[model samples]
Target: MLKDINLNAMNYFEAVARLGGISKAAEELGVSPSAVSQQIRQFEQQFGVRLFKRDKRKLTLTLDGERLFQTTTQAFRMMRDVRSAIQRQRENRHFNLRVSPSFAVRWLSPRLKEFLDLAPNWAVRIDAAPDFSDFETEVVDLDLRYGEGGWTGLHEEAVVHDLVLPMCSPGYLEELRALSDDPIGQLRQARLIDSVKTHYRWDFWLARHGVMGERMVYPLRFDRSSMALQLAADGAGVVLESSTLALDQLESGALVPLSTAFEAIRFPAYWLVCPSRHTSRRIVRIFSDWMREAGRVHDARAAELITGLGCRIREQSGRQLPGEEYVGE
Candidate 1:
């Protein structure tokens, strides 16, 4: 019967063979030199063969050791390839999604149930942050970005086109109604919550409306768009936000639109960004379909809310604005 060989000892032997010294192998393996030497000794004893000729300053592989190293190298290489293939298969069965924190919290979280319902067996890992760059090196399977579809070297698909409108909580609207007869004038009097870092700003929305007065400038600045939305929800101030993120609040009466004049910016509605090189894995394709459906649902809801509130939305072509009667699912 062939003797059962110790795998750990063989691994140590392989490391030493590749490195040419126990000290080097130890350093690579993050173990002590003594430990590597002991493992080599154990391996030699098991095989009943001296695998190395050790001098005061150097070590060389024996004839038997050379032959063994050749066989073991091929063996480990095959094992490594097999392991990698298995890992890729497992990853194909799952998805790692990355999104901006604001989109994840204000937009995705509210609608994730629908996605889960559609993809019951699929597992998802959401890495939510403001940054959505470097998806390829990070090994992220998918990313959602809030920008124009100009992410160079990435495969991007438009999820939804966005329109920015003034939104405030019901309490703030009540306060405004109490303070001033003109809602727009009252909005100027109230604190204006702003997201200056985003490509789409309140100033752009104001410019579209031809209201480029000093009131277009907001005093309170928020680093994240989500924070500005939350503050607006809390009745702190009016926020110019995407209808996609504010749909739930608007539908639930938590937030009210100040006016019907919403501006559709050239900024990417929303983008599903992925590495240009990565072919669509099964999980990624599934998630992509889910995202497309989610965007449709969001757009439908936003349109519904906007129509119900009698809001006017301009199309990208700069044509005459569509009438409220023309808006539908």
Candidate 2:
């Protein structure tokens, strides 16, 4: 008898008993009156008892039906309470974040304290990895990704439009200038530090400026932008890197523009990516808003720094430029 009990039928019966009419129950459940009537009839047949006593236009529960109704009501109320508790816990407890190592260190680490202060009650967790988060398997509430957007089935918005340029230590720039007066000659003779995993490499910057046919050698190479920027800051070599990641080094005078021959090339460097459902959560929305505002502030500061260096910013084409021949070693 316990195995044969239908929860759906019990739910329908509970609705009809509480609402006093089949139509009222159906309206609340978003179903037809006939559907509710069928379930109630099946529920009665299963128990071999009359769950409802029908009058001209009313539904009153039998003694057996009243007893069952009390149990069902208590059970449903408990379930609803559990669901609400879980939802509240998820929203108020912690926010999980995923981002690249370079971004985490250079961009987010310093600013994270501001967010923590804003929500002191919430615990924040960060996972800095190159791989994108699998929202299905991971407990990621937000993902700050570096890409051109268009992630399938996820909501993605451009958070940072970063510019790429060649930057090196002030001392290194002086040495390169001493080697040759011409910008192209200095770049050819000087060691270029290669950020091996960057989309906008030294080759891309060179090709965009039509600095072709000259063999450019990259003796120092690193997969991470942070390492490459550190190398450049230490006066090792000029590194083609994102202004967003190199903002601190630039501001501190540890790194300066390699040349003013070309403008900084713009690209959508960072994106706020998450599923549609998570976007509605209060904590996620608050954090996202803070990040967007922070990006705006950072961009303004970068603009001032670039203008101070006697340089300008320009948008680069999304398609790759045609000059890979000059890139070697």
Candidate 3:
């Protein structure tokens, strides 16, 4: 039976082997040359072999030394890997969810509380980025983005597909309600609050209805969709934006949809993204399922609040939006 070896001495031996000389290994280890040499000698003596054959300043490993080095090197590396893995376990309670600024404020922020309340033991860190997260490199456990489906190399699931309608506060809505004789004419006259950054612009939506706000020399410009929706809710101006973003305001009667021209944008649907490998994780699966259901519920609630053109939407019976289940599963 072999005796237990000194781990520290073995480390010194490994360093010597890696560096190819005792003096250099000593410098790297922040130790005196004599100390490293002595440690190396002791390690070799314990193994009962001449591990290295020295020539001038060169230290070449013998056959026996090569075999020992191969085993010990792998063993030491495994020790480091084990320690690192354990350290990760001790402090890896939080998982990251990268989201767009617009989605973060308008949709995700309110719903996050529910997730936190539900999963008290698990922590979620939201990284609200203006641009897309690099799923190939970034430590993004999940991402929420607006895009057309078929995101290659990553797992994605459509969360919400909402109608873009003209939204405004109660007084503004009431004003539009009075012009029921010519709703489009009144809408064209009003100060168009435009979300400048979005791909689906007011021009695109207006052209569809055979009328463009072409007469307006300058519309109020907000850089983000969430900002436009908030301003509109505050009775700032009429913002043509997604109903999903303004769902809370719509429900609260703070903001109301001005037109029944509910245009469902095909592209740029809200997609929950992650590396394909991560879907198998329990927490990820749980969050994915929860988010999809929550989106459905939100849409249903938003649909209930749509009072446009002197009409409220009463679903014929259990009628729901076209759903996109989690693509990862």
Instruction: Using TM-score, give the best candidate's number.
Output: 2
Task: Judging by lDDT against the true structure, name the best candidate.
Answer: 2
Judge candidate 1 at residue 108 and give its lDDT: 83
Write candidate 1's Cα lDDT for 1-329 as tens digits: 33598889898899899888888999989999999999999999988999999898588999999999998988988999999998887656666788877778877887788777776766778888767657646868888876655567889998876666788998888888788877556766777888764555666556656655565568789777777887899988898777777767777888888755443332346778888655457667777888887777767667766777878666553222232111100
Give lDDT tens digits, candidate 3, residues 75-139.
Answer: 87899899999888756777788877877887888788787776677768888776677877888
Lowest-sum lDDT 10-residue window in model 2: 320-329
How do the candidates rank by TM-score, highest first? 2, 1, 3
Q: Candidate 1 or 3, higher lDDT?
A: 1
**Candidate 2 off by > 4 Å:** 1-92, 317-329
Stretches > 4 Å off in candidate 3: 1-88, 174-180, 261-268, 307-329
* Better-scoring candidate (lDDT), 1 or 2: 2
Model 2 CA lDDT for position 35: 99
Give the residue spans of candidate 1 off by over 4 A: 1-88, 91-94, 113-123, 212-216, 261-268, 317-329
Give the 10-residue window scoring lowest on summed lDDT in candidate 3.
320-329
State the TM-score for model 1. 0.63
Q: Candidate 1: how large is its RMSD?
A: 10.2
| Higher-scoring candidate on lDDT, 2 or 3 | 2
Between candidates 1 and 2, which one is better according to TM-score?
2
